[model samples]
Target chain A: MSVPTSTPELLRASVEQFYARHMQLLDDGDAEAWAETFTEDGLFALPGRPEPTRGRAALAEGARRAHTERLASHETHRHWHGMLDIRPQDDGSVHVRCYALVVATPRGGEPRLHRSCVCRDVLVPAGSQWQVRSRRVTRDGF
Target chain B: MSVPTSTPELLRASVEQFYARHMQLLDDGDAEAWAETFTEDGLFALPGRPEPTRGRAALAEGARRAHTERLASHETHRHWHGMLDIRPQDDGSVHVRCYALVVATPRGGEPRLHRSCVCRDVLVPAGSQWQVRSRRVTRDGF
Candidate 1:
């Protein structure tokens, strides 16, 4: 389990590329692409009092709500992500953890911290891209 | 980028082990180990309406309070984790996403959901053990 730090760096560039693509999809309000990031049976979870819901479609619905309903008029919504870890799987997929900060600027509204998510993701190579198989966004606090 | 399915399975097992150790530390009330699971400058965040606090010491203090003050007993606390995805990190760490359900059976009280988290975690391999560099837990609304 103890890998040389260099190993992670080897995948850094590609991971960053995937991460960038993910961010772009969100920032552009491309829910379809965002949902396509994961596999069909992929789970998108938001854990807390309501309990987490599974499946890609459910996750897509959540994303749609966040992008349109929450920030309908936000001309500028930026999300920054840093991958804390990316592990290669035996099936050629990768498991990754990423830290994120989402800043939303809604016309007259002050720039606010809309959400911060720690993404735990499973990615499979789809064509030349890494697509998500399952993802969980664990929100902190009650 | 084009890894096979087996990769996810291996990564899942590794992540499960990491969570098992983490839950053990909490249930056993092993504060040091619990804290040690984080990096020296790790962020144990509790995401909320407001931004979350960062760093290990803060996380340790929070954990202590939850273990002692928030709950009446830790004897019947059960942590069930599901749907985890693992990611490899730049510094020999792994990023993970999983759903957690903590049900506590207090003495003379109905079992309650003490904590339900969509855990986003970064785990670095320190020697042979995995340590958390960042954990962002987000709470869900009804």
Candidate 2:
């Protein structure tokens, strides 16, 4: 694993951009593209889950199964990810922390706050882009 | 307004230690000490609040009135802050993102998850230590 040679500001910008792209893919329901945001062995786990969804294929399947089922067929999903704190580690993996607010709205109905969560991600640079090595999400208990 | 002379790793350790102390003081109901963790003009605000509670005096009063209210009269309160992401700013201040879990245990009742929130904080160096410049907490709508 090569160490990050980029300046802190540049590193932060890359992580932020990765997050923006990830959120867009997820909110757009492009599960395949969303999965591409992670490494092949990446895992997405929620609290109380015995095991995380490992591998890109599994990650995509989990997203669709979890959100698409609850989402109204007539509605679209929206996700807001902000309050980012990006830290670069010695091994070159960048740690990311942000809050994600998932909302659903029907064509004419009101938008609803479906889930509010804090997500931590370990992103490893792959070529010119970064891929999530692991993503652990904890939903708000309230 | 000095740039943080410390490296990213060292800065992270400092911020982590600060958060640990902050949580301990708040959980211990040491409002005075907790308030000292902020700058003289520090502001703590929540969503839906018109204005932030500013200044040391006001910050302490708010902490006591909010958390200490349930401390001994009704039940004990515990706050857990975790998943912290610390970022060094250009101006030497640091940006912090973390998840805070508040649990309530009635004198004889079961422990319950009271509230879950995502907090964003801007911490500036004051003398030898870091002080919170501002903190904005957003609660989960769910």
For each candidate in turn, the TM-score is 0.47, 0.60
lDDT of 1 by residue, A4-73 (tens): 2235543544555466557657655787787777777777666673656456677678777777865655
lDDT of 1: 0.63
**Candidate 1: DockQ?**
0.02
Model 2 misplacement above 4 A = A1-37, A40-61, A64-142, B1-5
Residues B1-142 of candidate 2: C-alpha lDDT, one tens digit per residue? 2334365545655676788898788877788999999999999988778898999999888888877577646887787665555677888888877666677789879876566566889999987688999999966543
Residue pairs with backbone atoms closer than 3 Å in model 2 (clashes): none
Model 1 in CAPRI terms: which quality? incorrect
lDDT on C-alpha atoms for all candidate structures: 0.63, 0.75
Tens-place lDDT digits, model 2, residues A1-142: 1233377755754565456557657755788889998999998888888888899999899877756764656665556677888888888888889898765555445445667999898999888778999989999984
Q: B26-127 in candidate 1: lDDT tens per residue?
A: 866676677777778877667552655456676677668767753555346767554454566555567676555566776767775554456788776666
Candidate 1 root-mean-square deviation in Å: 12.5
